[model samples]
Target: MYRANEPIDGGQNQNAATVPGVVARPRAIRDHLTPILDDLNPGIVAPEIQAAHFELKPVMFNMLNSIGQFGGSPHEDARQHIHAFLEVCDSFRQQGAHEDVLKLKLFPYSLRD
Candidate 1:
């Protein structure tokens, strides 16, 4: 099931050679995704919702994050990208939920940033 309480690691490449915070970490991404999953779960269920959402959350988040990056500019684009991404993700997520309910399968999400 899509539990809202799973510990989020942000999917950082743990094996990468890095000192620490210097790396472009996924902390923000994780933070962003947690609430999304929590918000989404009122409508989804799987034997492994926690694992599945964990696997898919970043993809959707990153995609939305990218759109904002493009829409915003030297002035400030993150907001644009984030907004676009979330809009798209929210629509797709609802669709995926409906599909999952019908097929009894997991919804696959992708982040193309």
Candidate 2:
């Protein structure tokens, strides 16, 4: 058990030594992390990438509905229905449709009530 102010080894505080040409400064956590954080998360995306992303359009609901619907009927072959749906999705993808937008927006329209 050692006292807080008492020197630990040979009457010297081993942790209190200062290095040559080095100055200790008080700083916030944000200050130390700002450079790393900035590198990891640049706030703004490049304009060309943004433009390319914005240009991708999802297939319209009406178009997807017109293509086909799967009602989960016992007579319906699930594999065939899934294959057909994926085929259509693939065609749309080839035409620059965003995959997420197509799946989220158009998939529901291909479901029969």
Candidate 3:
């Protein structure tokens, strides 16, 4: 049986010099793989998203808040609340703000705890 620390070929194990028990990848292979591994990493943000410009105006928040919080109230009309919200969103959309920014960021602020 061969031990992990013991050289298999008369003290000529190729990896023994670099690491006691671990093998080191060749420099060429490591260099070639680095860029591919970086691209595959999810934490890296795309250039487009990083360059995107999203401006949030206080008036937009006021408009959404004016529509009132829809907290599943039995007395409140959910459809009417939704219609008002969409109407406010449309007004902002016509004014050059992205719909996704309005929905994702400001919509949460419109909700009540």
Candidate 4:
């Protein structure tokens, strides 16, 4: 389960390899995922979220599960969906698993930069 309330400070246990403040924006971790986080209702894989939205992770969906609108919620944003899909593709590529990016949604180029 997603331990959102846990004090995310495992590095200070005195037996860890790294120290505090080494990770750089620990709360901004985009892929902080865990299985069976029951409170999230319909939790999703962390990688499904886009890196750009990492800072807004906590309040992004207002505590809803299944991404911003994967289940057809009214809060759906096309831009967010596109970004999430692209991020997933990037993650797959980083893992040496390539996916053919034939043609995806069209958005303003500036949004990427």
**Which model scores highest in TM-score?**
3
The candidate with the higher TM-score, 1 or 3, is 3
lDDT of each: 0.42, 0.58, 0.65, 0.37
Candidate 4 regions with alpha-carbon error over 4 angstroms: 1-69, 94-98, 101-113
Rate residue 81 of model 2 by lDDT. Answer: 72
| Residue pairs clashing, model 3 | none
Residue-wise lDDT of candidate 2 within 1-113, one digit each (tens)? Answer: 44444443545546754445554444688887866554486653332222245432444544566567888889888788777767676666523444655555556667888
CA RMSD of each candidate after superposition: 19.2, 11.7, 11.5, 18.7
Q: Give the C-alpha miss distance for residue 49 in model 1, angstroms.
A: 1.9
Candidate 3 displacement at residue 106 in angstroms: 2.1
- lDDT against true structure, model 3: 0.65
Summarize candidate 1's per-residue lDDT along 17-89 as a digit string, tens digits: 4443344433566686665454455554543333233334455555544454342246665565445544665
Q: Distance from true position, residue 1, model 3, in Å?
A: 26
Winner on lDDT (1 vs 3): 3
List model 4 lDDT by residue over 1-113, tens digit each. 22433334644544434445444334434456545466665442223423332222333233223333343356666677666755543433222222332112111221322
Q: Single out the weakest 10-residue window by summed lDDT for candidate 1.
A: 102-111
Residue 4 error, candidate 2, Å: 40
Residue 101 CA displacement from its true place in model 1, Å: 16
**For residues 1-113, what per-residue lDDT tens digits would candidate 3 score against the true structure?**
55455555646666545446654433566676666664475753323223246677789889988889888778988789778877887787523444655665666666676
